[model samples]
Target: MAPMAEPVAAAPAPPHFVIVPLPAQGHTIPMADLARLLAERGARASLVVTPVNAARLRGVAGLAARAKLRLEIVEVPFPADSGLPPGVENVDQITDYGHFLPFFLALKELAGPLEAYLRAQAVRPSCVISDWSNSWTAGVARRVGIPRLFFHGPSCFYSLCDINAATHGLQQQDDTERYLVPGMPVRVEVTMGTRPGFLNSAGFEALKDAAMEAMRTADGAVVNTFTDLEDEFIACYEVALGKPVWTLGPFCLCNRDDDAMASRGNKLGIDQSAVTAWLDAMDTDSVIYVNFGSLARKVPKYLYEVGHGLEDSGKPFVWVVKESEVSTPEVQEWLSALEARAAGRGLVVRGWAPQLAILSHRAVGGFVTHCGWNSLLESVAHGVPVVTWPHFSDQFLNERLAVDVLGVGVPIGVTAPVLLFGDEAMRFGRADVARAVSALMDGGEEADERRRRAKVYGEKARRAMEKGGSSYESLTQLIQSFTLQGGKQH
Candidate 1:
């Protein structure tokens, strides 16, 4: 052998990322998608979740393995005295709003176990990407010497407005006053009634402080949005944070196949095939898809109003009713009667339905949604216009983006936000719901325009994630930075 050729150097291992998501459906779904995206991009990504949350990831785990991606699910023990019942590790699982605080604060307990887990790993993660709510990770990242990137689940518009409103003390103003949010790229108005309940709760002040501190110390931020969707807001947010901000999303697109779409979030209550069959039977762009997100708790009156509104609209529809909302016997009877009256025209799914799959269906013309960021993006990505019905938190701000900025949504005329636990006074009844639904689903010039705009944005969203696209480039830059840092350490 001619002086044996010098052994070739093996390629450096791909950068490894540890992702921690707040244990809620809206937060975890996008984070899980991000984890998949990272693994797909030739990186080793692990998702740290509690045992209960791990169960929700089984489908994701299988899909990743099938694709030969280095995606993993790591389990850390949830604190024992978390004030939540056993196996209740997610925000959606909390029936009583009283446990919300304890559930939120309990996330801090994971920092210690998470740090130990990181130390025990054979290959240290190149970076730790965590949810903004899990602010405790800041200390862990600092102690472990791993760079931390905060992953925000909402839009740049919402984040910027929220920060500005809080900084300007707008939350303390009168509930009816319309105050222009300070320091935003656009003129966004907010009212105290529309602010999140947590903003006024003294019990939640500590958690909020910690989250703010974490943002101040974070290496940067990774948001689940595309620049094409929120270009100006993204630029403003980056400046506000005074750090690098990466926009690499509409992460739902990572779920390429039916298996992935159907299994994207928590386990389904109804069979995916059943949902598909129902949709396939309906006319194209004729069905209204209604969902209030995972955490919203609607009283019986609200549920009845929604049911009556859908029934009165006479449009083919699929409504997802939370199991918690139908606990009372009166509500159950009312639901049964409504189902009987609207058998073929309406389908009501109890508990979690395959939301992604349903929205992607051609039959879905419009969505009556709670204006959750994930739900809004999903609707936009699928070219489905929305009837915005914001609940709380950043939802009101998100509604403004969809209705005012994008012009792809019509508001359902609910002006005030309700507490998650409080007995909410019904503001908009069946008439408001029926009017919004009819305006969106029925053939009207405004409705057609809204649909057209949503379709165009949907196309832009898809293109943003393609190779060499804006989001793709951003993700590539982020990964390269991490890889370089990892190489230096080695």
Candidate 2:
């Protein structure tokens, strides 16, 4: 008999990724989700996070274990030179506004070790997916002969807004004047008063230059938004940046499972079951879910006005309040009064709520949000109409997308430019709040139309995440591109 053919050698694994995320809750969540998506597509993924961030990501590690995916978490010590306090690994921990520079500088200091770690890996990563803010990683990837892709967590529309502003020259625009973005499918207005402070800051200019240079020279960009949601903006961004763009998100939707949902729900320290039970008792589309995100510091007076407004609306609502924000006697008193006035129709959770779980629930009809990208996507994914209250960077632009481009949101009178550090001095009276809530939750022809549009968009978002959908196709193309030639930039 002919000698048995030697066992065929196993083919090598597909492209392995080294994902470096900015150490913040918003950045961390989507970065982790991207890693999971990569693993699902048969790529090995290693997420690099600071030690403190590593601890916060334990839940994700548990998630990977349960799913039995090829994902690993690599701890890279946050630089000692960052001058940050012992336990402060994230931007949110730098309570004092003065520490912002040091935090920015500290992020840069991680580059050396990151390069060293990449060089030492047994199977070198074929691609590096780093936060766009982490501009130094581009050079590191170059040194190691691998392609690097920048990841931006905000909407493509917001990016286009920034690009347009930079192109038109920030010096040419007056602080109070509105200007149209150059390449958008629809006209969107922006003013200096509405732009983020970092856009003009001398120090931020340096970082922005470095990031833009890296982005221009890097392989491509991977944004946490989908094509159907921002097709025009995505195309414009690609033309402006001169690189291939991958829109593989609504990343939150990609990883929605009972276990993943439960794990995320617990992170906010909320009892998921308890929250669901409360929703169970409410009528369909009766409750408005309110959360201003973890970072937006609510002004006490504004918080008080919100309390009175919710009370005036007389509608059932669930408000997610950060425990730290309301710890003061004055805010606590306002919260207590608000609760008393609501007469058992309102529930104020003083910790993290299961945001996705809450949004997906049938009881939640409207979202009163700060217009953060993640919250905006969640609102759209769940078919919940929004009352937009944009108070910071990229939020105002996102609000325009929801209210104008998408036609699924109502504005709540917050239009001033918000500085990065200071609170917005604008106050919404109780009447303003009540009116917005009533228009969203109560019956009205316009509100019904907005809700109908919102539901249609939500169905589109869901379809985009399924096999053969736009988002799924984008992910597949991204993976295939990486495997075949590492990466290609226009």
Candidate 3:
């Protein structure tokens, strides 16, 4: 009787993930959001970043505490000898594009320290979730005998279009030649020059090749997109990538709470309250919202011409100008003049902006965006039409998703894809910007149709994130799969 029964052993906890996103905002934000999503679904999570980035993400600890989620912030010192300026650990910090090569070199040095850190963790990481830029993580994951999942921070449509463009030999076409992306759900046009450099340049090819090779060798991909929005594209992406691809995305929707968002501080320093108040004062669907994301650096002339375009649109607007790019006194003077001329019709946010809040507001009629995946998803989620101004990388392809696949946008005439630090073949003038903005917001059959399609898509996006939705189910499956693998390890 005294030795009746021994206490049953407790079941082990789920997998612990070590997320290593590229230091860029576009990559970091989505990765962070994914971590939050995993934690919400009952998995242990940790994010590794440079000490500088860790400080930026300190608020996350408080966020997790409030949500009662499991998350830890692990910091590794950035290589001090790496030639980059002190505290300059991100791509956005390289004011001169000439330093990009050196910047990449510095990023490569992070792998060693990160690997050592993971090995020393008490609960070994079951997987290494890394951005496409961190190709070296594949090796690290292999060394540690863990799975690696590549993260693509863009739409499935954009990724598939790029894959199809390569498959159809569109990569060889001239700069301005428009060719249909093969095997797409709808007709989308792209030019050879609009493709990312890894496709053409000898030096940059190494990075692309490494990323693709890593994906081929890894467990699978975790794309930042959902099925309902790009069902056809998702199918095509799976076939092209030849791996099990999961379309659990619009990670922005994962954190519906205000506290979660506040945790990711606005790096741009814009006044959130004032911007919202101004937007609140505008009529529904009357004001256009403008932003080029964190990394885009528009030349002074381009900035001035865009200002003129905003003025000429005769529509209420809010524009975010990157602080680093608009440093000169002349540009500042131009911005001051633009704000003064608006006479309360516009708001110019110079530093940081709460982009999600702005997009969801009823007053935001259209988005003039650089076509970053996050911005594109936000615009689509809010059902706001777009005036696409693609700058680099996958942006041009994302523009096609809006203007071509979704029919919810008009291009601002960026025909040739501009490379990082490459010479501009054509400068965007005021006329082009004004016309694109007008086409999106001005009353007309075309604009109305675009608005209708956008609202419908937006509704669908919202539904996909709800309970029992496509994205919701996909996320559950993702966690379960990894958790099982983690259990096997122990």
Model 2: per-residue lDDT, tens digit, 1-490?
8989999976655778899998877777788889989988888788998888887778888888888888899999888867777888887676776777778778888888889888887767779999888898988889888888999878988888787666775443455476666666777777766663233555678887888787778888999887778898999989888888899877888657656766542266667888889899999999998888767766666677777788788889998877767878988887887777775699888877888888999999999998988889989988999999888778898999999898999999887855444455675688999999998888789999999999988888888888998888998988887776642321
Worst 10 residues of 1 by lDDT: 167-176
- Best-fitting candidate, scored by TM-score: 1
TM-scores vs. true structure, each candidate: 0.96, 0.94, 0.93
Write the residue-wise lDDT of candidate 3 on 1-490 in tens digits. 5777888977667788889988888888888888888888888888989887787787776788777888887888888888877778877677775566667667788889988988887767878888877888988888888888888888887777766665675533355566666777776666666763333555567777777677678788898877877888898889888887877778888767545555664454665667778888899999999998887777776778888999998999898887875789988888888889997898888877888878888999999998999989988888999999887778888887888788999888886766553325556788898899999999799999999999998988888888798888988888888777664332
> Which residue segments of model 2 deviate by more than 4 Å?
1-9, 170-176, 196-202, 419-424, 486-490
What lDDT does the true structure give each of the candidates? Answer: 0.88, 0.81, 0.80
Candidate 3 versus truth, CA RMSD in Å, comes to: 2.5
Sequence-dependent TM-score of model 1:
0.96
lDDT of 1 by residue, 1-490 (tens): 5788899987777999999999999999999999999999998999999999999999999999998999999999899998789988998888786888989888888988899988877767799999988999999989888899999888899888766665665533355577667787777777766653233566888888888889879999999889889999999889888899999988999887889987777778899899999999999999999999998878887788889989888899899988888888889999999999999999999988998899999999999999999999999988899999987888998999999999999999877878774336648888898999999989779999999999999999899999988899899999999887773331
| Alpha-carbon lDDT of model 1 | 0.88
Q: Each prediction's Cα RMSD?
A: 2.1, 3.0, 2.5
Name the better of 1 and 3 by TM-score: 1
Question: Once all C-alphas are superposed, what RMSD does model 2 give against the true structure?
Answer: 3.0
- How far is 2's C-alpha from truth in model 1 (Å)? 6.8
Q: Show the lowest summed lDDT stretch of 10 residues, model 2.
A: 194-203
